[model samples]
Target: MGAVASQDKQATLKGSEPSVAPLMRLVEPGMARVNALILEMAGSHAKMIPDIARHLIDSGGKRLRPMLTLACAEACGYSGENHVKLAAAVEFMHTATLLHDDVVDESELRRGKPSARMLWGNQASVLVGDYLLGQAFQTMVQVGSLDALAVLSKAASVIAEGEVLQLVAAKNLATGEEQYLKVINAKTAALFSAATEVGPIIAQSTADMRRAMAEYGTQLGLAFQLVDDALDYGGSSMTLGKKVGDDFREGKVTLPIVLAARAGTTEDRTFWSRTIEHGEINDGDLERAIDILRKQGAIAATVERARSYGDKAIAALAALPAGAHRDALEEVVLYCISRVS
Candidate 1:
């Protein structure tokens, strides 16, 4: 399955969308240290630990969450090395979640390659995920900031709750927009918020600055997930790092599906019921689902919602001191939303 965008639209997007080059360049030095720390922490006496960890870590993820921690700490004028440990912890937490998520979603692909669960089996994937989480906490302890540990540990709990909430809500057509937002808020935004918040905590920045960074991260995360939800129905596999209809096929009710199902016709409702609610998907069901989403303008609406959150994220950045890091962070938000444009 592929997206609906044409060659002309892709060409236009190339010129219009913001590039992540600035953020990447700004964080390069810190990310080098963070990368090395990640590898060191992931190592263990058991060879399978590092092998499974390296498989996903070496995969071409953008490492955006850890970069956010590095960028925020620098943006706040921190000159200490604890930020490096914190950044590694953030990445480990993210990797662990991805490993666990593959098992939960029964996903075959991640970052455009076979998932760890597919190659290593579900038991290995789950155990490796647990091992990574332990490493993450141990690294956080090394950071010597109780506040950072509190924030990240709370995020871990919230993420687990969010995953459970999503599992309970799966394939339930009655699930509304509010419940859907709650699910993403816990599942996605919690870690993003924690990732940015720890920067200020480690930097010993002002309370106001910490609040501003937290808000920025939360809004950026919401925007990021919303854009991903849109892309799942309207993007190419190369662009998404997974199949286009994975959400629909898995019976996950994201925002686009909620909006479309709410406004669709009686026959459309029945179609959703059978395919999504009852998991009775047929050969052409994915294409039909995409057509309905397009017809109802759900995809466009989802992108618009993401842009609104992106605006809030940028607004939150205003509280920070002006510098290249701040500007680069804003660009990161734009780059995230630009995936579907």
Candidate 2:
């Protein structure tokens, strides 16, 4: 699919976000090779996975996971075909998560398009997600790098854990920082850390270097998801793809709502426990949520937290030698804080 429509709106941070110009400039020959390998990874399946894969490949996500892999590989001085195969692996794992997530959340749209479940049916979507994960393992095996496989598998495990963790935490106002971190780390940061850190391992870099790059990816991933959660309440419904305030509507107690629940007035607490915590929101409940969120500064606080993670990502990059790839990584870190869609 082509790029989605962009309708401008006022925000605390909009165009002021960092540019991907540096990365854009660096998308030369090496990335082209990686892109070709991605096509190869989408192998033919007579049935089952292929049907769902077709819809998914056509659904038009930003291809951010694969792109991150390529960027990290280049940033860490990797100049090999491993980046392509590994990047495809990252995307497969991510796609699997989306497939499962839609089913779990009963979501109908993704990237403003019908979810796989909506178009293909639930069983097909779920099975295909499973197929992609299997495909990912196959992709990793082709590289013959146990180190890479180890990292990627661990990430996959964390992703699954995070999904289940979210299911458990939803509508529970008692979810605190440690629990929230557990969910996000398992759901978001794990893949990110795996994707970037794999580049170094594929390039046969030192262990310490891999550690730094992993930190960068983990922090960036956390930043990205924080903004995503914040947007669930604060951004335009259309721009957000999913419904506006869908978390509250679904009784998902994200950080913003969690903060409000923790610090709001007694009446607000009662409302939260009765409505969100109990999943009994009435018609006017969302507006009330907005009021409470604002009073608690949940939106602002979440954004600041995202920015802090972004800064940590940048700091992680300081250990790497200066280059265009590093610059691209930096741009992405900043973008995570401000992206509305």
Candidate 3:
């Protein structure tokens, strides 16, 4: 498909009305600059680096984290050019994580296409991911705001720690909600909080505003991940870009499984242990897993948790001034929750 048609396909993946379209509309101009910077920064003489990076970059993610940076900065009255650089940096960090993640997950598809690792090999994917991190840092330095740099740099570390935590926790049925939250907060929410927090930091907004933005992004990130886990079982390949039950196949102990396992009967517990803990998943196992999740109210519970976080994300915006940008930010929280509904 053509570029515009491709983007339209991505936008409509959620249904007749895409949740993120409003946020995209509000941030399109700023996003244009960020996109330009992304392309400029992704260039390299090695050719392989840029080729692999572009394969992922040009893939049809909504660029939600970077958009959060631009939107929050706009809401905080930041007209400075640094926001564009920071937004690009946010995207680089995110893209780098995805590259690394697909390698770790051994995922074949990303955003409805072959993953970078699938085409380029694991070694190249890892090196390209490192290259992206270098580019992300360079862009942050160009902004020349130590505060923004500190927030993002710290987030980069936290994201790595989160990745490690997930690795250690992977396939362990004993993994509780608390451990799971720490994993998601570090891997997912840390970048989000950093993306939004750096905006206010660059704008030199009040401490309260910065804190509020951090909270908003943190909660929103949690909600985003929760919905993603829910979708793995309930959504389609068209929506998720991978086959449904990929997570189950991979033995990831996400929230729905965690909840369902906890509430399961002895027989159900044995089933989880055999499939998730032991990796003995068979054909019909995914369907049985979904039934167990439904019977335990795990799916509904997961969505409820997401809704609670979405409410908190919205509540954080109250500290900011009333305006279209702020309203759009609030809509983003709703948009996130709407994916499951």
lDDT of 1: 0.90
TM-score of each: 0.95, 0.90, 0.94
Q: Which residues of candidate 1, in runs, are more than 4 Å off?
A: 1-16
Model 1: per-residue Cα lDDT at residue 256? 94
lDDT by residue for model 1 over 185-263, one digit each (tens)? Answer: 9999999999999999988999999999999999999999999999999998888998889999999999999999999
Ranked by lDDT, top first: 1, 3, 2
Superposed model 2: Cα runs more than 4 Å off = 1-16, 28-36, 45-48
lDDT of 3 at 134: 96
Per-residue accuracy of model 2 over 57-108 as CA lDDT, tens digit each: 6665666667777777777777778788888888888888889899888888
Q: Backbone clashes in each candidate structure, one number apiece?
A: 0, 0, 0
The lDDT values for all models are: 0.90, 0.78, 0.88
The best candidate by TM-score is 1
Clashes of 2: 0
Q: Which ten residues in a row have the lowest lDDT in candidate 2?
A: 1-10
Shift of residue 208 alpha carbon in model 2, Å: 1.5
